[model samples]
Target: MADHGNDPVVVIGLGRFGSSLALELARRGTEVLAIDSRPKIVQSMAGRLTHVVTADSTDLEALRQLGVPDFYRAVVAIGTDLEASILTTSLLVELEVDDIWAKAVSREHGRILQRVGAHHVILPEHDMGERVAHLLNGRMFDYMEVDENYALVKTRPPREYIGIPLGESNLRRKYGVTVVCVKGQDEEFTYAGAETVLAYGDVIVIAGKIDQVERFAELP
Candidate 1:
């Protein structure tokens, strides 16, 4: 069995998403137990993570031997091999791991993972596609969906709102969004206030419902 710090995350599968997530977590100093059935993959990641194991994640005995059940959180990032992905997720749920995050290749796959008790199912490709589409449709420097219908957007201050104090800009009433923070050409981002002025070169983060944000981002 692997030795890990308190509440280490168990990551099963060493594919692209799995490896990237494990590496990032390790880089951030989070204890991670990374598992992959391929010996070569496990060997390649040996020194980078807290622990690396080569074992069949779909097999309950293998998981049990590796002490996966003791993990507080687990991520199944199997990119292909749907059966392995589903079986691993089911095994994790059966072990009663507190949180299970599974990756799905399709909507149907995501639904199935959810039905089988995966706490969270992420479709990375689909999410990336949607995010890219949003970027392509507007002048936004970046856009992040804060929830189903709300978002946080980074963009250059619109010309109409420049040089005016945020309080009198009618942004909330007219555009249905609020500037949460601003970054000037030479300064770090700071919380925006009623008296904050939006200069031409300033960048701002705005928050609002998705539709309102899309409209706001479309401004000239």
Candidate 2:
């Protein structure tokens, strides 16, 4: 959970995905307002979100009355109705919301949302499948895209490098990767200027070009 209490977030659907996102954001202490066309869904999620509203998200007038634009970010989570999802997203952009995230059922739907000014579009099922695949592979712990050419990655230490000293490894010269942080169970993480020795079970946070990082992972 990320702290977002100072950031107002609006979730414009109360379906399973929308409601789950709203609850997670609320748990993170964000000021979250959830809306749905279904009164039953709104009623069920009332206790979990900071605020809940029952209204058709496609209605621009209804959205305006709810001060949707005042939110720092908005999520269009209407899954089944493509028209309603597009309309809600468009209305949010027109109101000049700072950021907007849309859920797409397919590649075409994702592209349509992107053209309409959505800051991001998510294909939940596709993303989930990829995540599960990563977990099964067990080589990469997580991946963070830093830019077009670079990424920050978390991975287990290579077997041959498990007992090496940070200063002696010369990972930058050998693999072109820079260790950003080293985490050990017994001590706090060392960032950049770490003078610690690597040990088994320690997670390494490295930043570099994607190819170089992957090369490092391939080391025995």
| Best candidate according to lDDT | 1
* Residue runs of model 2 more than 4 Å from their true location after superposition: 1-5, 145-149, 192-194
- Model 1 segments beyond 4 Å from truth? 1-6
What is the C-alpha lDDT profile of model 2 across 39-85, one tens digit per residue? 88888877777689899887888988999978878999999999999
lDDT string, candidate 1, 142-169, tens digits: 9888788999999998889999999998
- The deviation in Å at residue 67 for candidate 1 is 0.5
**TM-scores for candidates 1 onward, in order:** 0.94, 0.82
Q: Locate the minimum summed-lDDT window of 10 residues in model 2.
A: 130-139
Query: Over all chains combined, what TM-score does candidate 1 have?
Result: 0.94
